[model samples]
Target: MALSDIACRNAHKSDKAKDGKAFKLFDDKGLFLLVKPTESGWGKWWRFKYRFDGKEKQLSLGTYPEVSLGQAREKRDEARKLVAAMIDPGENRKAVKEARADSFANSFEVIAREWGSKKVQTWDEKNNRSKRMLERNIFPWLGAKPIADILPKDILASLRRIEERGTIETAHRTLQICGQVFRYAVATGRVDRDITQDLKGALPPAKGEHFAAITEPKEAAELLRAIDSYQGSLPALCALKLAPLVFVRPGELRAMQWQDVNLETAEWRYLVTKTNVQHIVPLSRQALAILLELQPLTGHGRYVFPSERTPSGIRCMSENTLNAALKRLGYGKDKMTVHGFRAMARTILDEVLGVRPDFIEHQLAHAVRDPNGRAYNRTAHLPERHKMMQQWADYLDALKQGAQVIQFPRQA
Candidate 1:
């Protein structure tokens, strides 16, 4: 006979002293409430006794009142059904527990970090930049969410927050990386699909403002004169002078090492940090003079532009060093940025000098392809680039001397 709820609530514990002994109140379908003796707090537990594969087993339904008698009966019937199908309910519960553990182990952050660790090897400084962006933007909001459970709205909300800070480009890039992570998750079977696909055209278009550059010959000449007269630190003076000649990114300039320079060949070769391509910067007579002048000060250390105040000199110049120098020289960020040097050279070299676009692109380390769809290797137009670099340096000198502007015919 099944036990009644009235009988369960009024049940009494046995006074007999026994170790781990309990009095059983049997219910239907092998369900029973075990009332422990008074020494054991008279606790009650629901148990289901069954057989599977000709073997007897007992499954604990749960404690009484917490799991009501009605609930215990439901669980007993379900386990009996499993036993009829020759399955062990205890093993099934263990499998479900393991599955849940696997899901949490493959959570979004865990998978993203695993993917990031593999990706950062190819990315140089971008590794740190990506880590910072994730920690600041993505991780706080969605890092703990299960990858399989994250909806498109969750991703869009995070990206929209980034855009709120006026870094739309960063938002776009973060979305791109998120898509990569999602695709990786899909490939690994952690998630069913990459919902980032659903977010196409979701963000506002990136509003890109070109770096402030002085394209006009006369204005560039004035800027050059101002830079030449800058009486800042020797590293700053050298970086400013070399900025126009090399036109590398500011970070690249700050991280320049001494070993990559070859004064005899008049060339400075280093991996372009942005593109991860080996780039060769032809050192003009003017550029070489500036490097040689600073060689005495920073040559002993690892960096060609080592920080003066740093004791170990392990770190190079600060990223803001040139921009700060420009500020002091009255070239506001709106008037000129350290990055504007690349634009300055790109505009002047093509508009003023008769250098071919291909030669200029090669020197700039930009990835370009011919009509044959073959990507031009970094060393593709080395000889022509060398000549073009020298002509560009001479043109800057002519401009600084207040020479008359000469316009080149546009290439067809």
Candidate 2:
């Protein structure tokens, strides 16, 4: 006879004084609910009993009430199907668990971390942009799955999550990063092909937005002179003083930390967010003096330009702060941008100063390559760049004093 729901509810109720002895009520086939007496009432565990590999084995379906009689019967019938095929259901469960654990060991997240750790070492400034992207967008969704098991759809799903967040540009970068990982996986023999290759043109294209810049030296000199005479907060003043000197991306400039600077060495080192590369900016004498002057004021906080708000002082200034200060100095977004500092330096360094284009690109944290087509490590050409930075700073000072523009012969 089949076990009824009422029988399950009252199971072990009749055996309270059995001194912790357990009993079982069998349903049709090999399914039964083992009722164990507890302090409050009873613990009903549904179990399926069977024999396989010339030995008896039992598998727990689930607990009663939660599992219910109907559900327990369904589970038992599925397990019976496995046994009928001469398979061991108990061993099958263990095999499935072991497979999952193996997949985790060979997971995309694990491989990505391995590749990033090695790649970040080659990249100076220890900028782990790949690691940051994996953690933020990819890991949460696709981290644990086996790298071999991840299909193009899985990659697309993760990329879409980033796209839906309105970070379409970041979504594209994330896809590029994924492609790198897949290539690594291919090289390592983990996968036969790069799955991200199948995702070409899957995402909508991201439009480029270029910041306005004053490329002419005479115009830049006027802007530099204005920055010098502008009245502003000490941080803003120091920022204005050093902006044209270093010409780092405004976000990198604003988020500059005290710990990454070495006044003795005249260097400002940090990870550039856009390229995810560690960048070293050789500070000019003028730039160092401005820094040393601002030290006594903002040296106490995490950021060199700490936010004015209480408790938020750990963070850097708001994005609009520098542009607002620029606006106050009469150079609106259409005329000049904080990012334009990079463009100004790029144009002048190559066209006017005759600095090596490679050095200029490296200083700007762009992807620079050697004649052999390999990226120069972080410390490449440091001494020469150090000299060039000082010269650039001196040139700016001369411009501020209304000196004539001196042009150097272009590199052939």
TM-score per candidate, chains pooled: 0.68, 0.67
**Against the true structure, whose TM-score is highest?**
1
Every model's Cα RMSD, please? 8.6, 5.9
Given candidate 1, what's the lDDT at residue 117?
80
Q: Candidates' lDDT values, in order?
A: 0.83, 0.85
Model 2, range 1-412, lDDT digits (tens) per residue?
8999998887766654267688778898899888877788778899999988788889999898999899999999999999999888888999999988888778999889877767654222222456678889999989988999999999899999999999888899899999988898889888999989899999999886679899998898899888888787888888878888898888788789999999998998888777777889999989989999999889987778876553445667656778888999899999999988889989998999999888888888888888899998777888888988998999999988899998998654
Off by over 4 Å in 2: 6-14, 17-25, 35-43, 104-110, 117-146, 149-172, 195-211, 217-243, 249-260, 269-280, 293-338, 350-362, 365-384, 394-412
- Model 1 bad stretches (over 4 Å): 1-117, 120-128, 183-193, 306-311, 408-412
